[model samples]
Target: MDAEIGYLTPGRTRRRSIARTIFAGSIGNTVEWFDWTIYTVFAIYFSNQFFPSQDTTVALLATFSVFAIGFFMRPLGGWLIGTFSDRHGRRSALTLSILLMAVPSLVIALLPTYSQIGVFAPILLVLARMTQGLSVGGEYGAATTFLTESAPAKRRGFYGSFLFLSIALGLLIASGIAWVLTNNLNRTQMELFGWRIPFLIGGLASLIGLWLRRNVDETQAYKDMANKGEIPKRSLRWIWRHHRPAVLRLIGTSVLPAFSFYLFVSYLPIYAIQRGGATPEVAFRASTVSIAIFMCALPFFGRFSDRFGRKPQLIAFACAYLFFLYPVVNSVGSGFWSVLLVECFGLLAYGLYASIAPAMMAELFNTEVRAVGIGAFYNVVIALLGGTTPYLMAWLQSINLESWFLVYVCAGAAISLYSFIEMPETRGKTLD
Candidate 1:
């Protein structure tokens, strides 16, 4: 590992440079997440377009199954793109990931319905989602490494929080658009065409993200590794051989965050509409409000982690979910206010982990392997747990055994709490 340097020392790296880096890193992330979130948010409208099933639940199941299938490609994305980032540079990899996401999003926007093209419609949708899965799989690691490495050591937590801040922004934009479309268009109109608008918007916005990412400087950490000729042989076998424990630690730390994140941010709104008796508009409105609040709270928690410690906040998050998630989820009612309140509480707890997760995870590996290390294992966990959350919830709900899903989440929280307790504190730690 290269020794920590004064590359980001106060006088050397100006505030403006850091601000631009944060914006560049965050904007692309926002676009990536926007595309991902819109798929779920708009799935209800479009599920029948591709699946053509009589049973609404069956169509949704098929849609969400495709969602999980997309996740199957994430680990490969993480490995390939992560290695590319580690070898080429964060900026290049980020730009490539956005390009990957942009094309597939546009494809989804213009895709023909099952009635127009028969079984090919669903097949095309699956292929598009798989490609998007690849893009986002790579996006998280490269962007997280870029932001965390670019920040001053002491402020890594605060800066890292922007990742989820961007994510919240993306979710808010998606939910707001859904609200507008649902309000303005009739159900038939939405089912027929309105769902494609957000995908179209996502595809176009990605170009802006690409431009911003292309203009940003490569992270100094990567530059330093290059200058020192310390770039390691990029291989999954090598990473597994040397960084095995770190990989396991990351997976353990990620389980609860992965499950709870998808549960709160993506699936819960659907649950509210389907089971909690809230209307679609009410669910979207509540989601929009709660995400806005979650976005606002991320930086505060990030800053707090810098002051207190990452472990403390992460522990609190796990403990809260472990003990309170069942009750909180159960208490959700049909009202907009009830949904909003439950979402806000859950997301705030998640913010504690989201704020500093990038910094904490990046600190676990040396510069040579940081991006790939995180990309490989973190995404695998996300693919396995996070990507499956919505499907599992829907499946459980279908079986009238939804409460069992809560048990699964609590188990994940228990694992994460143990991981947090055992993991070393990373506050203010310089990245390897």
Candidate 2:
């Protein structure tokens, strides 16, 4: 561990740089999630454009399958770019991830429909989603490490909370936009042109993400390790030799958050429509409202974690889910209020886990391999569980066993609960 990792003399100039770094790091997170989620938000509309299926459920399953394909690319992205970040620099990796995301958004925006290009349309859509997946695979690890390392040691949890703050905001904004589009456009309009609007907006927004990230400074921790010539030549080998325990903890801790986030947050709108028989507008509106509350609640949990401890909050939340998830999930019915209430309750429960994760994950590995370790561990879990969750839930429901989906998510939470029980408290620990 390097002694010089978090040193900073108090000054206005330095404070401003920290603010800029936080903004630069977090804004791209917003864009990355926005671009990623817009596909899910609009999947009901756009699925028909690419997948020419007579069965509506088949078409949606096809679209989500493409969404899952993008997720499969995440591990590769995490490994390659995370290794590059370990070898090169976080700033470079961060910038490259945002740029990679922008191109896919633009491609989806301009993509020809199956009506025009037939078989080629779905292929191009899958390719674009795969690229976006690659970008996000690297983005979360780089941005989380950057934000956590950039903050003052005691407040790392508070600052790191912004990663999910941005994610919640992104999903909130996407839901809002989707709601507006659904309300204004009829089914025909939405299927034909409305879906493209959000993708184009996301593409244009990526340029701003590129600009902000370019201006922010790199972390002192990474620079200190690099300057001292302590960075290992083979980062994966270093992890295997020294931090394999952390890797297991990472997987154990990562599964529930990844799985539940997709199930409760990303999949909520669709769930409302399919299981609850709500309208598209109602579902999107419910998500927008619930996510707004979720976004507002995150920093409070984060700051609380900074004061109390991450492990306690994580365990408490997991226990809450273990006890309440089945009841709450079963209570959901075909109404706007039921869907909205369930979504809010679920996100609030999730905030307890999401708020503390960035700091906890950063604290697990030393600076030498933090980015790659986080990128690989986190993305692999997300690829396997998070990406497949929506499809899994949909399939379960189709098979007349949707209750199994609830059980699956609860099982994931239980896994995380056990991991958190065994994990050490990293509160007030300096990023070294």
Candidate 3:
């Protein structure tokens, strides 16, 4: 780590320069989500190709179970990489994680199917997912913190929304890739070779993202901390001792957004193709369209929070989301227009939470423990709410209680709503 640094007074950059930094921070996040969400979309096809076990459904369940494991590994990724980020620089951490994810995706793309390698294929699948998981786990904290810090104070909330917008873009790419492969390839082709295209695309994007990130400046906030040698060596301890309330607050606040986001992007396709009598191609098309709109809407809400404060935006979204959980989900069975109508509203509400989360979470702590505190808390909630949600929905479906599953999602939003109502706003406030 170089000790050389300089002072940066607030509000001192060209608009284009600031936009570049935000884009750089955002692209890597976009690539990460591309690879991550691609795994889920393609799993429907490749789970059978790679993991041919007793039952395809059961194998997919197990595969996704391991998929959830990747998320579980994220806290460690956050703690280790985040500590390095807090101690050294967020740029370094962000760069390393992007490359970490790229390599695994490429390798997984090239791996042989079950017929060629037997059980070793899925084992390799699990191993690759774990590696990607570790990278993404660290990537979120580092990148989110980087963008929040790099963003101008007046626009931090809106700029931090870049994190989710990029995530939505990544998901869009994943859906597009899946759609192309499924539509263009014959069943034989998809099962054998077509499935690799998305992973290859993801890996290549990650590399390009790595190059883009190199041009961005180290965050001025982290630079100042380094100049003074004031970074906490044990940020986890500080968070545990001084910031536990904030951590708990973040976990509760994170649940509704996390749940709804995953429900829309991660599980909805599964529901459509498997339960709603839609083809894979149809499901991907609907989801792709919905995500494109969601991505575009993020910046609007992101900027909205900056003007309106975080709490009210979150509260309004929470109430609307709880009301729509079951109705929107069930309405999707009606066909293209209906699915789009339902998902658009659902994802729009979700965008409110996702867009502001990175900035709001960063605000919960001073720069000292910002990374680890956000990482651990966010990962724990995602573990409970996001990682298990599809499985939970699947379980509910098995019990003939699909409507009851809506209750689970609505309940999560209510928890976050109450949490949001009480959580203080940090709009335009500087973190020291």
lDDT of 2 by residue, 66-167 (tens): 887888898888877888887888899899999999999999999999999989999899889989988999998888888888888888888988899998
- Summing lDDT over every window of 10 consecutive residues in candidate 2, give the lowest-scoring window: 1-10
In lDDT terms, which candidate is top?
1
Cα lDDT listed for each candidate: 0.88, 0.86, 0.81
Candidate 1 residue spans exceeding 4 A from truth: 1-13, 52-60, 114-120, 267-284, 334-337
lDDT of 1 by residue, 136-240 (tens): 889888999999999988889999999989988887788678778989999999998899999999999998888888889898889988998756677989988
Tens-place lDDT digits, model 3, residues 170-235: 777776777667778898787677778889988998999998887778988888778886665875
Local error of candidate 3 at residue 381 (angstroms)? 0.6
The TM-score, computed over Cα atoms with residue i paired to residue i, of candidate 2 is: 0.89
Candidate 3 local distance difference test against the native: 0.81
lDDT score, residue 45, model 1? 94
